[model samples]
Target chain A: MDRVTGHGADRSSGRRPVLTAARVAGLVGAAAYAGLLASTRPFTVEADVVTAVALVAAASAVVVRLAGDRSVPDGIGWRPYLPWLVMAAAVVAWELACFFGGARPSHPTLSSIYDIVARSEAAKAAVVLAWVGLGWALVRT
Target chain B: MTWRSVTFVVWTVLGLATLVVVALAMAGRGRIARPSALLFPVSTHPVVRVLVVLGWMWVGWHFFAR
Candidate 1:
């Protein structure tokens, strides 16, 4: 009951900021992406593109929400995240290109990209950039 | 049931089940609690990763296998 539902104020007192819709959306997008990646060839490249777009959009929504959230100040040191934001967009674009380039089964480059998404230069940089941004938020007033 | 049909249904069930469980679990936890507390903290971590891996493997088998 109370343990499962977390129906108290302390639930909001975690080290991290409260969960925002954007973050939730990002989680949903990730789950969907993972689930969809499993399915084989009946789907077209367009579907992959759609999945990528949805993920990036979900992530972008989180960024936008964070930026707009009143608790976050205008001069928030994390503002530098906007650049990483651009980089995130670029990563998604690269992913989309590789993923949807060919017709069925997608291009090898796309598979390679995903193969490394768990660990890739581009992916690593993007993830680092995001971490730096969050660090900025955490360290700043 | 055949393997193909079973795989689809498994994924379908897993995907839907995770969502329903997550939703109810999340909602059950007031929608504001950290997911860790809502779900079993230990099982939530590694099991989620395993579930993701297994879920995709199942989907791949469903889509491309002969």
Candidate 2:
């Protein structure tokens, strides 16, 4: 009798898959976020945005892998860090938009954005989608 | 019950559900095995991999970095 593994691989050969650090990190992050969602206050706009992004990122990753496109690059060198740079840029842009654009308070922190978006369902949904898309991109490359 | 109380109850349930799922994944048992198996590929993807890192960073940034 042969034991079948989740990836459709045969495990009867007696070789167990080794869990890598990256995989551990992903699992821990997902678990932590889910925990946060459950233990936090009424869903703040910022929390919602982050949740939406995580779901979208997870979904997109599933789709891409299922598509069977092996041509995707392996993120050589500094490519992996690009998303951090993008996030930093987004933070700066948020600050500038809040200050100069006058659409929000002088300091546009997560709390400020949450206060503004929490009240409006449409605004909240839109911001969630936009942030999720950015987050998806952040993960993609 | 007030909305806050209702939310608290709801979240408590959700938190339990999340804990169960995490536990299953950690143990690699039951129906979650397949999905847990897929996590390796998903995490390894160049793009998705970055999100994992960023997600952890986001947690720190939001909760501690202020």
Candidate 3:
């Protein structure tokens, strides 16, 4: 558990000031990419292009992870993951229930609520960027 | 009132509860592990890692494209 969780280490220790030129350029580039994606209509060629990029990136991540260090600690049972599993299950259950209940305005599923937020291009771009960043984080693990 | 409204309320509560749990974990509260702490080890397994990344890709496509 300690090996996996770093139970004794300072959790806040990793963060550092990374405001270099390359970091700034990377942030700006991501924002520009997200903005460009958001400008296109959904299901269109432009949209599909960005989506393809994400797909390719994720596929590469999987391949890299598989080809790299594959070691994992033994005997790390399911108990440690129970909290996340339960939370995810609860969220998904309600999403399904709401969808089955007709997904009307009165009973908005999470996606429906997100639809309203994503109506704003800026918000849509932010979410797109966040989704990409989250994928990278998960893949690096 | 209606079942729809009640369902919406429950969904809101679930969202809020999840947020609370994440907040607690971020704060380093006892018995609540950080999400990174949990996810890092799980992702070490190649199959689960692939599934998770694929799920993430699906989400991006579902919301942003199709």
- Candidates' chain B TM-scores in the order shown: 0.40, 0.66, 0.73
Q: How close is candidate 3 to the true structure, as a TM-score?
A: 0.84
Q: Each candidate's iRMS in angstroms?
A: 16.6, 14.5, 2.5
What lDDT score belongs to each candidate, Candidate 1 first? 0.41, 0.48, 0.76
Cα-based TM-score, every candidate? 0.24, 0.31, 0.84
The CAPRI quality class of candidate 3 comes to medium
Ranking by TM-score: 3, 2, 1
Pairwise TM-score winner, candidates 1 and 2: 2
True interface contacts reproduced by each model, as a fraction?
A: 0.10, 0.07, 0.44
The positional error of residue B57 in candidate 3, measured at the CA in angstroms, is 0.8
True-vs-predicted CA distance for residue A94, candidate 2, Å: 25
Better of 2 and 3 by lDDT: 3
lDDT of each residue in A1-141, candidate 1, tens digit only: 233334556656557856889877755655554444333222467445533443344345445544654442222222223333344465556456544655423333434433445344445334333433332222221
For B1-66, candidate 3 gives per-residue lDDT tens digits of 987679768977887988887887666533566666766664657777778877888888888888
Interface RMSD, Å, model 2:
14.5
Per-residue alpha-carbon lDDT of candidate 1 for residues B1-66, written as tens digits (9 for 90 to 100): 653344335435544644554565445535433234322221223334334334433433322221
